[model samples]
Target: MPNTNGILGRKLGMTRVYNEFGQASPVTVIEAGPCVVLQKKTVGKEGYNAVQVGFREKKPSRLNKPEVGHFKKSGGTGYYHVREFKVEDPKIYELGQQVNVTEVIKIGDKVDVTGRAKGRGFQGVIKRHGFSGGRATHGSDFQRQPGSIGSSAYPSRVIKGKKMPGHMGTDKQTVKNLIVIDIRVEENILLVKGAVPGAKNGLVSIYIKKA
Candidate 1:
């Protein structure tokens, strides 16, 4: 079994497991596939090489006519999540093939986990952008404000890419080089060391980190 580009999985929250050294390692447990390969794209046709994989199950009624037809062609029921991963060899995969963690990933391997971070909704500069807020003492009325966003008649406008207070979190985040601590093929679970993005049960993409 050669290394695959990536796989789809659900974040099963975090837990701790003891290693052979009797040291406890915090791990984020992911309920990885059983993912079905829905389609394969080639550079000559789609202008890129990629494989579309689906995860989890969804009701037939929940999908539209086109989606229903698409999945049916691949001999699969509706899927809750569907995504594409770029591959070096798309021809190796076929439609309707099931991909589990054990085939591509193993314990001690490094992976890049991608998911949406938890949304912190409308926030101030201090918490959002890590700006140190104003002094709390000494009659400080300017506390907690994003001080001096605009300057006097220079650029005349708030600069682009300025880190200011606004919507926070809920962005696509990728944590790279997380070591795979364990794999349970029976349960289709992968335990990776350290933290990953997204809340519990959120969709996560685990890919073998590129060298």
Candidate 2:
């Protein structure tokens, strides 16, 4: 059966590890937390049910007074990262309870991950929106340009939400239904099939996928 709980893990760089047949496999080493339960949301109180999980504790001096009060109410140190996850059952959760990778994960399960995509600053239409550029042989003046951005005198204005060149990436993205191939309880690690989103050490949120 698939585990209902989700884990918050950090990408601990990538490496190649051998499988059972002794074949090399590309693996992303993840450091899944011992996340603390910051707050327990209930149906009546928050109008929904969820658990607020916190990871990567910050130093007391690094936190402000308001944050200090929040963590103190839950009897925890300064937690740098905090996220609210929806859970159907609040019976299994409690305030200040610690969560780790091992509790919620098994060897094989489907999960979805959300993260920030890599930033490719100021890309062209050819690269950003996949528009075909001008011919390389001829005088390709419009080579990388977005080309006539507006309707010629008919509209006489740049259309709203045009797919022109500008900023690209560093956007929030969700990668769905990734299979968890392996789990290391001792190291608090998970080996998922295929690549996860974002650069190394980027914050990624793992959740149970809908069947």
Candidate 3:
């Protein structure tokens, strides 16, 4: 409704949906929108057109003084998540205006879902990079170890950007071109075909595909 093409939402897990042909398709459930416009930026003033919105209202007591002051203009309401989305014209959206999921996207639309992937916490190369481990028979000791990281005489150091055993996941990831299977405007629920990144109840940003 604000000339924006994206919305902030929460991942509500995955479920299967049946089509008219009786085919079951896996879909990720997302609780999208009802986002409030916190601020508006115009091209004349901010050198760009964008609308800043907030989702998941939070208690006023939980927010700091600066945060409370920032939300003062927007009906004195606090939110847990705040994100800025580019808009064609920011003047059309008023401050504190609530945006619903139906306004930005609809069923059969293609969207890009962005979220933080689940953290695996210090994973090895086998699980992290999908490296095939060494032979498991005949007293082979190099089962899961990352064999031969670097040359001893040539580079003399471990190569940068090399896939090695380290921290895995918990990074921002975007799953592009996911089809919107269904939408329940009353419930603010969106069913998207295929799996998306992140764990259940995680925060995600859904942007309609421009092309």
**Lowest lDDT block of 10, candidate 2:** 1-10
Q: Rate the local accuracy (lDDT) of all candidates.
A: 0.90, 0.79, 0.94
Q: Clashing residue pairs, candidate 3?
A: none
Query: Can you tell me which runs of candidate 2 are displaced by over 4 Å?
Result: 1-4, 22-24
Q: How well does candidate 1 match the true structure in TM-score terms? A: 0.95
How much is 86 displaced in model 1, in angstroms?
2.2
| Model 1 segments more than 4 A misplaced | 1-3
List ranges where model 3 is wrong by over 4 Å. none
- TM, every model: 0.95, 0.90, 0.96
172-209 per-residue lDDT for model 2 (tens digits): 99888877778888777888776777889888888876
lDDT of 3 at 35: 98
Give the clashing residue pairs of candidate 2, or none. none
What global local distance difference test value does model 1 have?
0.90
TM-score of candidate 3 to 2 decimals = 0.96
* Preferred candidate (lDDT higher): 1 or 2: 1
Q: Model 1, range 1-211, lDDT digits (tens) per residue?
A: 4546889999989989996899998999999898998999999999998989899989887899899889997894889999998888888887888888898897898999999999999999989988888899989898889999877898899899888889998999999999998899999999999999999999999989776
Q: Report model 2's TM-score to 2 decimal places.
A: 0.90
